[model samples]
Target: MKIYKYILIGFLIVTTIFVSNHGGNVSYALFYLAIILPIISVIYTLYVYQHFRIYQMIDHKTIVKGELVPYRFTVSNEYFITYRSIQLKFYDDKSQVVGGDTTVEYTLLPGESIEKKTNLRCNYRGEYEVGIKMVVITDFLRLISITFPIQSKYRVMVLPRVLNLSRLRILPLEKDAKRTLTCNNPEQIEMDNELRNYVYGDSLKRIHWKASAKKQTMQTRKMTQNPRQEMNLYIDLCKLDVTGMDQIIIEDKMIEAELAIVKYCQKMGVPINVFYQQDGPQKRRILNAMDFNKLYQESPKIKFNQKVSVHELLSKNVINMGKCLVLVHKLEDALCIQLQRLKQNRAELVLLYFTSELEEEEKVKIGTLRSIGIYVREILREEELVNIL
Candidate 1:
């Protein structure tokens, strides 16, 4: 609060009353003026405090990116008077506090609530805290002031934006359409309702909000497993590969290869099982009837969070994918040996090894895997992926 305004007003009033009464006629008018100034200021301050307090309420506890989210804030006052210049402030988790302050002005009556709403666009993905940082309310006479809390905070979750690209080729190598998935099918089993913790690429639908709020941590959501016939997606990331000129190039290739596999499985109308080597064994997660756009984006982040080895993934979970398809970065003898073993043991699968470094190796592994009952083919050049098989 600005004490100078009150002091100045009191001084001016006292000077005027004392001068007028002493020089001309009113007797002890200054004494009456002094009595009234304190009362008026006290009342004004209390009125301002009661009327200008702001409270913000957020509707969405957590939200996914690219979804329209809403928020409401209520401004209250003590008396039935309208405030003219009261302004509200806004802030979000990814604080780009370079603006000249965005504010909205409104009026309110005593015990009245003035609510305001606005939509937030999903720009960047991650966890976010959004709400009022500080609110400032002032008097028309330029006399008083007050500041609100430092952290007016609310929680929100923003996920990555996904674009639909299933039309593009480089899909999974398949012959007949597979239909092993049925919604809430008996193939699924209820695991644990208790959420553990949240991983980066977890589906937004799997989030357990009640547990998250209670624990105040990003909990891994666990739900009943569906009876989805698992299909394998082996991204041909040959360890003994060549040309590391651009990591981005290699990463893009891997992403495209994985996308092709996923799109193929999705096109076949079959449920897919995705795995990437993390800190431990290949972390397995099921993508059951997921949106095509979402599947496209999630395929790459798996590598960002884990260094996946195709051989290890196959050795561990090949039997689960049913008839599996492998995308190899190069035609290494080690991978060829593994494919031969898989096919020989009745683990009928397809292997497509694509080498940006060696186009010839793409079909090498395919031929080898097919020799032992596994249907396999090579996706050598980028153009071959776009062809209608």
Candidate 2:
């Protein structure tokens, strides 16, 4: 294109010199053509920009992370002029086009169209645009090019993938394992006459129907002692001060690891209490497959911009005894203090530290955490979850 522009400039200069030296009919005609040539090229570029058409479709608007979705896009020329030097650019930050080159160029004849069918894979859990992001159009004379950003964005929501684990290596699953060290096969508690409002994980058999009818609210018989030793899973929702892509990778891994543990517990018929900071301190109890399904559906929309930190939540709601699992991206001093406090309180702590890269300082902290009897697993990538957990 630069060479073409230079040639056009040289032609214009020669025409101007001829018309200046001898004002003949032929010189004037050449000069006029030279002046009008660039005008025609600009008009042609604009015409192609307006007459070009693009259509894109996907098999579904929502997909699991790392799963390929069928995608197709078509580029067509609607006008009578042949479309030349059209280029396509895709969004490669969060999602990618599979099994083909990403940068594609095409030339379409009048009323002709070109379609490409390929698979698209989203790399993280979130809502983002994918496929072609912009179109580049160049004139026939190759003197100029205009870039047009695609207005219609193909956005899709990617949910985290749940791994079905036959057994969890994080905690012992043996029949003779201590009840305090394992989440499976918790001892059932006996109910007392004291009644309270029914919680999500409360057993249906323990519901006090007579007290509920009188109080106009569902009630359940309270247990004298603590209930079953449920697994307390805490997910850190505090936003990280990092680049956009780095943040997505960290957050997606955290979510997927948490979900994989939840799925394992569900398979073992163990109740789990999930804790995170949303509007404030939020908790969700998963008791069965149906409860796990609800959490899976809402995973993609979960945000990481929480005002409260996981350390603050743990301080306010301390667990004296139970199996607790904490998922965090950063190892801060305050969070470490909280984890140590939980360990001192006889709570079985399993810390899943997620990061794209681990630092030397974090390695020392991991050693300290392990010294305090806290099971610490540093997850550098998503694939580590399968073996580490």
Question: Residue 357: error of model 2 in Å?
Answer: 2.8
Write the residue-wise lDDT of candidate 2 on 1-389 in tens digits.
Answer: 79998998999999999999998999999999989988998899889888899999999998998999899999998889899999888888888988546446689999999989999999888888999888888888888888889988898998898977766777744363344434554345679999989899989999999999999999999887545557889999988766667788788888988899888877666778899987777788988889899999989989999978888878865766478888988899999999898888888788888887888999999999999888888888545577777
Q: TM-score per candidate, in order?
A: 0.39, 0.83
Going through the candidates in the order shown, the clash numbers are 13, 0
Clashing pairs in 2: none
Question: Cα lDDT of all candidates, in order?
Answer: 0.55, 0.84
Say which candidate scores most in lDDT: 2
lDDT of 1 by residue, 155-271 (tens): 566544333344523333345322242233425455477776898988777788887889898776677655546666666443434443333344444555555556555654555
